[model samples]
Target: MNQHKKGLVVWIGIVLLLLAGALLAGPGDRVETVQETMRDAVLHNVNRISLLGLKEVNPGLISAFLVTIILLIAAALIRIFAVPRFRYIPGKLQLLLEQAVGLFDNMARGASPHRFRFVGAYIFAAGAFIFVGTLFELLGIQVVTVGGHPITLPAPLSDVNAAIALGTLSYLVILSGGVAANGVKGVGKTLKEFSLPISMSFRLFGALLSGLLVTELVYYYVNLSFVLPVVVGVLFTLLHAVIQTYVLTMLTSMYYGEVSEPSPPKPKKKKQASSPAEHA
Candidate 1:
């Protein structure tokens, strides 16, 4: 009991000291107003990058490329170094990998039992991309913009374009599955749900953007910038990562299953019996 009381008192003292220090410190050269900060969070400044002679690119695009490269490299390394050493009694790394793969496999099977192989692969890839891409922001890797300003690379999904592209790509995959299973009839079925891409795009964009905006808001104020931003940013990012990944993958698999279901055969018509008078 005494130790607990001592620990609490020590923590309170440290917090008081930090609060005093923050109160004494001046807001150093903050020219941007709260509105400006919020605006910049939504519509990033003219910090564009030129790629392959293309001018005025969003930083989120760069972040997407970075995340893609990272995932590709990691996959290559794992394939080269990890797969050959699998044992009947699994080790930690192997167990972890198996569990992750099994999760999507089971989900796909449950949702699209008729054609789950492709759906499982597609959803697994999509979920990994989303979950990893959202967490990428936590790295705090900074890149220099065309305007010579250093800005942290935001999550790819936070950008509207990236979200739309992912959503459209998932829709295309679902459409292809339908076409493969049911042909023209499947295409007609898939086309009926035209708003899917839009809803998916905005869902990802809004969820990720909310986290980014909240983090930016927290860091904008000097008083609250001490330890609160870290906790808030991490919690928001982690929550968004898990929730968005699961939501997108689940929706994709469900829709894919629905569209790709085979059509039931038409019942054979029964022959009419001849009347007794005609037979006589």
Candidate 2:
């Protein structure tokens, strides 16, 4: 009972200290209004980046590139140093890799048994990209804009263009699976759901953008900025990362399954017996 009371008192003291600090800290210089801050968060034009002698590129594109490079490097390193060390008994790394691969493989097989191999590989790559890209924002990697303003690179999906490209790519994969399985019928089937790419693109964009906007809002205010931003930002980012990854992969697998389903063989027509009268 005494230990519990002591712990409670410690928490109370910490809270009081935080409150005092917040009170003592004066309001920060208001360089931008809340509206302006939010607007900047939503619009990439405000803080355009430069890449390959090109100006006005979105910062999210840089984030995407960085994430891609990171993944590639990690893949190469693992292939070089990790795969050869694997044992039949399975260590932590091997077990983790197996589980991750198995998850998408199982999902794909369950959804599209006829063509799970490609679907599994595609969704695994897509899921990894989405999951890693979303969490990349948490690293708070800052890049200088073309205008010399330093801004933190946002999640790739937070940019509509990245999200749209991914959605379109996933749709194309599904369409290809359909074409491979059912030919023209598959194309027609996939075409009928043309709005899928748009919906998927916006879904990813909106979810990631919401987290970005909220984090920006929290960080904009000086008083609320102390500890709240960390909690809000991490919770929102992690939640969105896991949720969006699962949602996209699951949807892709399900749709691919639907489109790639093999057509039932046409029933054989029963031949009518030759007319007995004509035969006679």
Candidate 3:
């Protein structure tokens, strides 16, 4: 376990090294301070919004959304068209996915057999959303705008990232489902259910954002030597990535656990005797 974790850290370091090399340069004046970028993002993207004929067009959000949608489509297409019989992908990928699903299903069943479906549905949705977010990061799509001058919000209805949309949709589902199931009594339970996904998304975004900020700050001030920034940045970014994945998976388990719990069966009413059934 320790060795595996260590390897993951090393892998993260490599990724961060690559990302930093691409985003941050040297001690030259061309370097932009984290504060400056943040200020630009915040000022340029506060509450202000622009709309065009029922369409919203925020460049950053749109980029993220489009990339997310495209990736989802590609994944779908691959699943539908590319994935072949047992001869296609080596045993590894298929085995891993099957094992994961089995493990999750077993865990969920332990909670309640009836709830496994709901939990599985959520796990699928959340996984899709996170996968999209990861792709956005890889593609260098800036979902959050930090500094520009006066901040402005993008189109609300049209340009929302997968995470935000997933979180919002889950919240609504929980809220509505809980209400219908138990009325006001289920509100708290439903909210708790909703938080799993919302927190997962926020936790991920926050970790990545912090890593980004720290990397930028280091390049701005410390003026570190070669390879050192790479090492540190990689450390932080990988930490963020791992933490995010763990949190997401854990929440998925929790949701599945909850939904799987079985409700007690209702007792059937006893019929009244009619004078020994009229001597029947």
- Name the candidate that leads on lDDT: 2
Rank by TM-score, descending? 2, 1, 3
> How many Å off is the CA of 55 in candidate 2?
3.1
lDDT of 1: 0.88
* TM-score (C-alpha) between model 1 and the true structure: 0.89
In order of appearance, the predictions have TM-scores of 0.89, 0.89, 0.56
lDDT of 2 by residue, 1-280 (tens): 9999999999999988987888688677776689987887887778889897765789889999999999889989989999999999999999999998999999999999899999999999999999999999999998988878788999988888899999999999999999999999999989999999999888988988999898888877768877787688887788889999999999999999999999899999999989989899
Off by over 4 Å in 3: 1-33, 40-60, 87-90, 99-112, 141-165, 173-188, 191-201, 218-225, 232-235, 252-256, 259-280
Model 2 stretches astray by more than 4 angstroms = 1-19, 268-280
Candidate 1 at residue 193, lDDT? 89
- Candidate 2 has which clashing residue pairs, if any? none
What would the per-residue lDDT of candidate 1 be over residues 26-119, giving only the tens digit for each residue? 5767756788867766666555665556767887888898899999898888788887988899999889889989999999999988899998
After aligning candidate 1 to the native by TM-score, how far in Å is the CA of 178 from where it should be?
0.5
What are the runs in model 1 whose C-alpha is more than 4 Å off? 1-17, 270-280
Pick the winner on lDDT between candidates 1 and 3. Answer: 1
Q: Report lDDT per candidate.
A: 0.88, 0.90, 0.51
